[model samples]
Target: MAALYTTRSLSAYADLLDHAGILAARPEAAAEATTTISFATDDSREVQPGTLFVCKGAAFKREYLVNALAAGAVAYVSEVDYEIDEELGRHVPCLIVSDIRATLALIADALYDHPSGRVSVCAFTGTKGKTTSVYYLRSMLAEHAKEHGLPAPAFLTGVEYDDGVEQGESLLTTPESFVLERRIAHAAEAGCAHLVMEASSQAMKFKRTLGVEFAVGAFTNFGEDHISPIEHPTLEDYFESKLLLFENCHTAVVNLDTDVAERVLAVAQRAPLVERVLTYSLEREDADVTVQEFERTDGGIRALVRTPRFTRWLLVPSPAAFNLSNALGAITCAEALGMSANAIEFGLASARVPGRMELYPTESGRVLGVVDYAHNGMSLEALLNDLRAAYPDRELAVVFGATGGKGVDRRETMGEAAGKLADRIVITEDDPGPEDPAVICDAIAAAVSAQGHQAWQIVLDRSEAIETAVRETAGQAVIVVTGKGNDPFMLRHGVREPYEPDGDQLKRALAEWDAAN
Candidate 1:
C-alpha cells in the first residue's frame, strides 16, 4: 500500500530546501518544470507516479535511476549528477543535493507529517544488549500507560516491530530513514505516545536516523563486533558510530559497568546536544541507579535497585545475570522518562525477550533444552559459564555453530569455551551466507579437537544436529541449542530457506527420542 503524502511542486519543494539546510543547485529550467512529488522512496521498485526516487548508497547506479523513471518517478534525488538520455532527462528532474541520506530523511519526515515531533522517541545502542533493552523499555512504557489508561507504546528493534497494533519481523536493526519515518508516522496515528527502538552502529554510521531527536538515548555495554570490510573497519570507528545517538538525544542513560564508561560519559557530556546524563550500574554504588543485590533464583534473577526517586526489588524473569544490568539500564531510561516505580517493577517482572536465554524442558526428567541467540564467542562463553555455575549438578552440553563470512574468531573461541565447560558438544551449520556450511562446521570441529575434547560430533544439517544432541543425552544432561534461536530462516549461499524454530525442533526431537526409547 502507498503511504500518505501531500503533493508539493518541484519549485516549491526546492524553495524549502534552504529551510531544511539542504543546498539545492539545479538548472532554472529543471526547477521551473511543473513536476509534483506525491511520494518519496529510496528503492527503485517502490517508485510510483509522481514519486521522488532517492538514489543513495555506494551501490547506486544509472540503471536504478533509469528504472525509477521508467516506473513513473517524476524526480530523482541524488548526491551526484547522473547521465541520462537527453530526451528522458527533459521529463524527469534530477535534484542534486550535497547529502542524499540527510535529504531523504528530511523528505520522509515532511511526507510523514513529522511524526517524531508528536511521539516520544527513545533509542538504545550497544553491541550486546540493544534488542533486549528495547524490549525492556517498551514493556515498561506499556505498563506505565496501562496504569494510566493510555495507549500502548510502539517499538522497532532487530528482533521485531510493534507498530502500535501488530508485531512482525524486522528487516534491519534500524531500517532506512524513509521506512523508519513511515513506521513512526503509523505509530503516531495509532495513538502511541512512546516509540522505543534500537540505534544500530550501521544505521548511525550511514545517517539513517538523522531526523528524529530521541527523548532518551540509552547505552548498554559495548564490545568488539561488526568489524568487516562492509561494516565498521575498526573498533574505534564502531564505537564512534554508536556515540552518534548521544549527539541527537535530549537525555543520556549509560551503563556504568561498561569498561569504557568514563570515556563514553565524557563524550556524551561534551556534546552540546546532551542536556542530562543518567547512569546505571551493578557494581558502582554511587551511580544514578544501582543494583543493591542480585541473586540467581530457581526461576530467574531477582535484584534490589536503588534510585533517588525510589527503591524497589526487580524480578527479572530470566536466568542470565547480564540481564540484571540490561534491566537496570532500561529502568534508568524509564525513570528519566518519568515512569513510576510500580510500572518499572511490573514491567521487569513480566517482560520477556524471545530467543534470549529462552528455556524449554522435555517430558523426560533429565533432558533440559535451552535456546539462546548467543551467536558470538563472548556471549556464548558468558552464558555457558553462568549456566554452569547456576546448575552445578547438571552436566553442561552445547549444540552450536559459527556463522560464515563473519565472526571468524567466534568459531575458535566458541569451541574452546565448549570444550572447557560442556561435557558433550555438537557442531553444526549456522548461516553460512556465501560460504559452505561444511567448511564452517569443520573449522569449529577442528577448534574443539585442538582443545583436546573428543566428545563432539559434526552434523552439517542443523536440525539433525539438534535432534542428535537431544537424543544422545536425553536423560543425562542439559542441552543448550545456540546460534539460531527464534530466527525464521537459515542463510546459505545468499539464499534464506525456512527453518524450524528452536523450540519447535526441540519438541519434535524430544517426541522422537521418547517414542524410540
Candidate 2:
C-alpha cells in the first residue's frame, strides 16, 4: 500500500503542537527531532515503519504501544508517558501534550497536508434529520457536479462513507481524526469538488473534527437526546457540543422552526470564524429559505418553496411532512453553495436516504409497511404523527427496541411516544450488548404501561418480532419497523454478530404473509 501522507520531520510536529499551546514537552534530544514520520494513526494495529502512533481513548493500553514499537513505529504521542522497560521494548522518542484529542486532530491535519483546505467541505449537526439532510445536500451537489462535468461529491453519514475513491458502510457517524483526514485527502486527490459530512455531538465534544475548516456548516434542529453518563450528562452539554461546529465554519445555516432557534442564532452570530449566517424555516416568511405551503401527494409531498434567488414548487418523494423541513434545509445549503435552481429541484426529487422513511410494498394492498431509523423519542414521535396524518383511516403498529448500555433514558421516551401515538407496539431486541434482551424490553414495556396503553407485546428475536407485527396486523394497518434500519450487524456482548437488516426482514415477512394468504 502507498503512504497516505508525506513524510515530515519530528520537529515540524513539535513546532505545530507548541504553537497550539498544547505541547507540554518536546523530544528529549535534538537528534530525535530530525526523525521522519511517514504515517500517523491511533490504531496500534495499523502501525508501520516510521509511524507516529497516538495514544487516545479511555480503553487505551500500554501493550498496544509496545506492539506499535515492535512493528517499527518511530515515535508516539500521548497525554501521559508509559515508562517502558528497556529490556522488554525498544526506547523511542515521544511527545507529551495537555490534550491528546486536540493534538491528534492537529497532527493528522498536518500529515494529510490539510486536505479540508483543498475540498469544499460542508457539515451538518443536529439531534435529528442530520443523515437525511446530508443525503439531500449530496444529491443536489452530485447532480450539479454531473451537469457541469465535475467529479461527484463525497459524503460521510451514519449509513455510509464515500471518499470518491472508495465507498463502504460507516462504523461511526463521525470517524476519528486520522481516518477522517485521510479520507478527505483521498477525496481531494480523486478530484471531488465537495465533501458533505455529519458533525455528531460526541465527535465535536471530543475534538475529532478540530482542525477541519468547513466551507458551510448547518444546524438542522436540536432536541433532548443522547443524555446518559457515558454520553452527554445533560441536555445543555449536548446542545453546546453541537454548537462547536460554527466555530470553524465560514457560513452558518440555522433552522428557525426549531424551539431553540434564538439561542442557536445568537451563538452563530457570536462565532468568530462565522462570516455569514443564513436562516431557513417551515413557518416564518422572513427566513432565507421558507416553505410557503405544502400538500400530500400519492407519490410524496409537494411544497411551494421560496428562496432568496427563486420561488418554485419542489417535490420531495416521501409521504412524511417532516421531510419537507429536511428538504428545505438541503435547499438552504445548496443555495449557499451557489447551485443552480434546476440542480436543486432535480436532486430534491431524486434523493433517497437508505433506511430513512423507506416504504415497502405489500402483496395485499390493505397493508402498508415503512422502515426507518427513528430510535429516539423526538424522531419517533415525528415519524408516527406524520404517518397518522398520511394514513388517517389505517391502524398504526410500531416495532422497536432501545439500545443497551447507553442512552438509558431513551427506553421511557420511546415507549411514551409509541404508547401515545401507535395503536399496537412490539418490543424486541436491538443491539442488547451485554444486557439481557428481556430486561431491556421490560423497561420499555413498563413505560408503555405507564401511558395506560396495554396493547403491547414483547418478542425477543428481531426477525420474529417483525414477522409477528406484519402477520398479526394483516389488514388496514401501517406496520412501522424501526431502530436498526439498514445496519447489518447486532452487537451482542462485545461481538458484532451478522443479522438481517430490518428492511430485508420486513420484506421477507411481507412475502410470507402474501404466500400464506
Candidate 3:
C-alpha cells in the first residue's frame, strides 16, 4: 500500500465531523487529539500502526474492531462506541459520528487531499451502456493526452480499473468511498490529467461518491433494472439516484432518445452545479450531437455524427449498432472537454471493451459465437433484437441465467425476450448468491416456456452451457453467451467460486469442435 502523502491529527477529524453536523461524541483522551494518523481503513485485516479504523456496514462486528485494535489501530470512528477493554493495555481514541458512511467519505476526501479537484473527472450513469461509454470516453481522452505528450488517462468501470498505479479487474461497479478517493489520488499523483468512471445508482444513494465533483457527467439511458428489496425498492428511486450525478457535474451529457429524456434534461438543467447541458440522440436532429446515419461495415460500424464543433464521419471498430449511441455520448463529453475532432475519431475507431459485443473465431468459420455483459432484462432484450436483425437468416441461440437474490425481475424479462427472439435457449447459473442455482434456472425456464419456446434446457454449469450451445448450433446459427461476460468468478452461496469467463469458454468450445471435425 502507498504511504499517505498527507496526514491529519485526531482533532482535525473531530473538527471535520463536527462541522459536517455528524459528530456525536469526541474522544475522551485530550492528549490523543494531537496524534497524527498514518493511515485509515475500514477492513480490520488491513489495519497498521497509527491506523484510524472506520466501522462501516450492517455486517460490522465488535470482533472486527477488536482485531483492528490488536493490529495497532490508534484511533477509530463509528456510529456507536465499541468501548475498549482496559485489559488490552492500549489507550485508543474514539470519534463517534451519527453516520459512519458519510463520515468515512468526508475523512477519505480530506485524507486524499481532494484529488478529484486536481484531475479532470468524468463519470457516466445509467442502467446499461455505462461501462461501454466510460471506455469510449477514456479512449478519446487517451488520444488527446497522447497528442499533447501527457500521461494516459485513468479509468474505473465495471469490467476493470486503470488508476495509473494499478490495473486489474474491478469487483464493484463503483468502489467504496475510501478506495475511490485513494485511486483518484493515485491518478493525480501519476500526473494523469483525466479520470473517467461509472456512477452506479447504489453509489449515489449510499453516498459512495460523496465529495467527488465530476468535470463531465453523462447519462446513457434508463431502464427497469437494479430493482429489488436490497437494491432500489422502486423504479423512481433508481432513476432519481442516477440524477444525482448531474448535481455534482459542470457539464451534463444526456441521451435524448431515452424514454424519460425530457425529465432527465429538466433535472440536469435545474441542477445548481451543472453549467451546461448537452444532448445526443439517434433519432433527433435538435440534440447537441446526433447520429445522422449509421451502418455496419466489414469489420466495424460507420456513422455520420453531427456535433456543434464538427459534422463528419466516425467509425467504431465494433459490429454492434448500439455502440453508436455510446460513441455519441463519448463524443459529446469529449467536446465539452475541448478535445479535437481528430482525437475523437481516432480514439473511437480503436476503442474496444472486453466481453462487450466480443466475437469469437470459430473453427468451421460458419458459426458465430458472441460474449456480452448484457445481464438485465432491458439490455438482454436489446442485444437479442440486435442479433436477430444482424443475422436474419441464421437461427439464434442464447445461453444466459439470471443472478440470484437481486434484480429478481430479470428472470422473467430475460426469458421472455430470449424465448420470443431466439430459436434455442440454454438456461444456466449466474451468480446464485446464497440461493439455489437450480431454483433460479427453473424460474427462467418457466418464463421461456410461457413464450411457447420449448427449445430450452437447464445446464447448471455455465461453462458447459456455453459449450453445449456452441456444439448444438454449430455451422448454422448465431450463439450468444450473456450475463457473466469475462468476469472470473461465480457467486455461489455468498462465496465467489473460480469460474472461466464466457469468452474463453466459447473459444475453447470452438477449438474443440475444430479438433474433432
Q: Highest lDDT: which candidate?
A: 2
**TM-score, every prediction:** 0.93, 0.97, 0.95
lDDT of each: 0.83, 0.91, 0.89
Q: In candidate 3, list every pair of residues with a backbone clash.
A: none
Residue 381's lDDT in candidate 2 = 96
Alpha-carbon lDDT of model 3: 0.89
lDDT of 1 by residue, 144-186 (tens): 9999898899999887898775679987989899889888887
lDDT of 3 by residue, 1-517 (tens): 4553468888887898899899999975574566788788899998888888999989999899999988988889999877785757766788889998888888888888789999999999999999999889899999999999999999999889999998998989999998999889989988999999999999989988988989999999999988999999999999999998987799999999999999999999999999999999999999999988888886788999999999999998777778888889999999999999999999998898888989986666677788999998889888988888888888889999999999999998898888889999999999999889999999999999999999999999888898898778645678899998789999988888898788888988877876776
Candidate 3 structure, TM-score to reference: 0.95
What residue runs in model 1 are displaced by over 4 Å at the alpha carbon? 1-6, 9-24, 29-35, 89-91, 474-476, 511-517
Off by over 4 Å in 3: 1-3, 28-33, 85-91, 361-365, 511-517
Q: Write the per-residue lDDT of candidate 2 for residues 1-517, one digit (tens) a residue.
A: 2655878888888889999999997776674666888888898889989999899978899989888988978888999877664745556788889999999999999999899999999999998999999999999999999899999999999779999888999989999998899889989989999999999999999999999999999999988899999899999999999999999999999999998999999999999989889999998999999988989987799999999999999989889999888898889999999999999999889998998999987776777889999989999999999999889999999999999988888899999999999999999999999899899999999999999998899999999999889889746888999988789999899898999999998988887887777
Ranking the candidates on TM-score from highest down gives 2, 3, 1
**lDDT minimum window of 10 residues, candidate 3:** 1-10
Q: Could you report the Cα RMSD, in angstroms, for every candidate shown?
A: 2.4, 1.6, 2.0
lDDT of 1 at 117: 83
Q: Is candidate 1 or candidate 3 better by TM-score?
A: 3
Best by TM-score: 2
